[model samples]
Target: MKTNYLALLSLISILPLYAQQVKFEDFFTDQTMRIDYHHIGDAKSELVTIDQIYGYGIWAGSLLHLIDNFNNGAYYYKIYDEATGALIFSKGFDSYFKEYQTSDAAINGIKKAYHESAIIPYPKNKIRFALEKRGKQNELNEIFNVLIDPADLYIIKEEAKDKDVTVIKALYNGDPHTKLDVVILGDGYTSSEKAKFEKDLKRFTDLFVSSEPYKSNKNDINIYGVFKPSEESGTDEPGAGIYKNTVLNTTFYSLGSERYLLTEDNKTMRNLAAFVPYDAIYIMVNSPRYGGGGIYNFYCTFVSDNQFSDYIFLHEFGHSFAGLADEYYTSDVAYNEFYPAGLEPVEPNITRLLDKNNLKWKNLIAPGIEIPTQWEKKDYDANDYIWLKERTAMNKNIANLKRNKAPKEQIDAAQIEYNNKDKAHSDAVDKYLKSSKYWDMVGAFEGAGYSAEGLYRPMLDCLMFSKGTKPLCKVCADHAAKIIKHYTE
Candidate 1:
């Protein structure tokens, strides 16, 4: 009876390999629609495409990852006319670019070694392919079928265990800015109080959207909360519940000293991204203290600490939203070397202003504020300038500020003490940066406690880069506007 049931189910199931006829016109209901696939690769590399996973077309913007597994390439599908199997429309779904990731690291390493003479070691690849519909009138490739690993493709489920009621309520904003789909996930503490959790999460998001910049275009943003239960303190201190398994004593002393687990990084993201059509992600963990992180064009994760979660969420969102770099140089951190001095940072905010010609925020700077403005202790807390330097001068893990550029005699002693605590320092820095290990992972400076000085932020002090209340700076606010524009009809 079991075997008979299996056979019956197989007969009723949709075949993964079957090709459905389609017409080019019917697939794209919006005549003015456009799908932009960024980051393609060389043609010499393998390219793969799979068909019809979630009624959407798929393509490989980059081919490096597919070549590694040539036996199976990425999959894609087409929606076309059934009778003639005529070509209609197709697209690439969920493209992965691991090889591109490896090459990026290699290039960065070369830059560090070469200094001023450094160059972009590897050129970005450009991979483009034209897909034909299964039963097109042209019928250029009727017999051929694109092959892919069925498991690699993600099928959108019909229902989710969790949904953001806040997003649904604000779905009717009038301005209709190109809204972003945000999926926010919480840590273990949230499950401790589910009802309040949902209400608080929704309330915060509402407050978030209601705030300036986003307020006028509220309908343009979709926010979802992924609240889960956890057993960790949600502060920025070392070893806070997320780093329990490291071989080293990776504790964040700022928050209450609690054991943290490192494994939750990617898993938390997967759980949240699983529920929405996010072009980018914003993660809000449940914690009262503050801590957060973000990467440009990547994701921003923050804690919902009552003390400063609101501002922190927006500040970190700055990095994720506009590639803004931290402007604050005072704080405790464990990194030995971050900026190379010679190379210009990719972020829009802080820069050496090397080629004032190509500065990302050149026009946004206050008229006379000098680039790398004079290092005046009086201006340390001022918003008109940005700062960057090591977190401490004590060489001990104590929290205090001192100019890193003092006389060499003093530097020598600090360096010596720093060397003595090399293991601990390295452990702390490693735990902070490079914490998340994934191909597209954009956080390496997370956990390191430093940020730019400013007041207008989403929260007081968040993990994004630093804390404080300030709406998205003009640079970030512009980026947000562009993203919103992209999705607007």
Candidate 2:
């Protein structure tokens, strides 16, 4: 009798707390489709660049929102699935203008633009988003209601700041509750362009939300954009000249080149981390320039631009966001011998094949498919191959004949042709590796596995790092899907 009485009391005491949990359906009505952009300068008019249409357009139909904020930013809370504990949604908004001027300036500009027609002076300063989670815990419950199976619940308060940048809190409610969020910032633009940028993002998110993986748990995701205006519109490197590629004409300040290169600037990385507690943070470089990078357990991202921007965006996202290893290895890179032969690589595509009897995907290989020696000298003719001959001879320290060493009279002819053709091969590799839809994993491609010396990939044309129908090998797909399952509710 005493035990029953205690159990009843426990139930009574927990009822209030349980009632406070936030549910996913509650915030649907509260979402506001707002316009966002930055004022770079008056030197350029409010014009839409072609790069924007192509690059950002690729993700045209996607959904994004803050997973943890509600009720005009009164409180904040993040949601995670009970089964996996991966964070699927979040919004951590809890800052006032006094904490930083970013949200304040952005709010002012937005308000001004909403009311006036005149062009406003571009804010020279850059605004970063930050979250305040230390105080004001009471109001959180009213705005957000935490829900597990829509039965248990809690509430929380959050605040959204309008300054030089519109900053909001975010959270993860996926299976793992793995703290992850992305801040998609745009380049500098005029007031009109800023408005357009916001519209474009809204459209993109709408499409994203309708997609397969995201549509499954649309309510649990939080996505927001911070309008940090650069000095000019389009692709550009800070304090550098504009670069024109096949798809975009913009300043390419990062490494001062249109092609992909790492930058010395760590500000974007540091500031992004400060905004939210993220297990993985991503930077969506707003340019039509095709490039991206992924720092494991840190961050991953791609730039915005045309000229194969859609393909490159997904490709880079696979690398930066999913840790997918490069599958193509024939193109020129500055590094050498990245992967040792003995150590087993974590990436699914490349393998030591050390123990073919116990190989990773041995079952998938066709019965009697020739293992090792499949790509012996007989596969490729040794002589009369100018490109292969040069690379092989160089690696072997073999000197070329007289005519090969002479400087060519055509300045841009040979090098340009080489770059263009080489890029085509790389594009082909990227396409195959990212498709993630087909292929059996038995061996390596001729030029993959980070072997600067060899150009082999696991499959004849798998997406380890190539283009077209040779979908991402099976192992790579499983690896990427594992992460998706981890973070989805």
Error of 2 at 293 (Å): 2.1
Please provide TM-scores, in order, for all candidate models, with all chains considered together: 0.48, 0.48
lDDT of 2: 0.38
- Residue 48, candidate 2: alpha-carbon lDDT: 15
Q: Give me the runs in candidate 1 sitting further than 4 Å from their true place.
A: 1-178, 190-192, 228-268, 334-336, 365-372, 375-466
lDDT by residue for model 2 over 1-489, one digit each (tens)? 435533543463445443345343432222211112221211111211111000000111112332322222211334333332323344332211111112333334422111101001111121111122222322323221222222112211122333555543332344223223444444434445666667645644554445434445466565555564444555544322233221112233222222443322333333323333233344555654345544333344455544444445445545644556676554444232445456554445566666667665565565666554254323223321344445444322211221244344342354444446545645643444445332343554344654534434456554446443234555565555545544442
Q: For candidate 1, lDDT tens digit of each residue in 169-259?
A: 2233332123455556555443346665576677778777876566776766666665554445342333212333221111233222121
Model 2, total clashes:
122
* Candidates' C-alpha lDDT: 0.38, 0.38
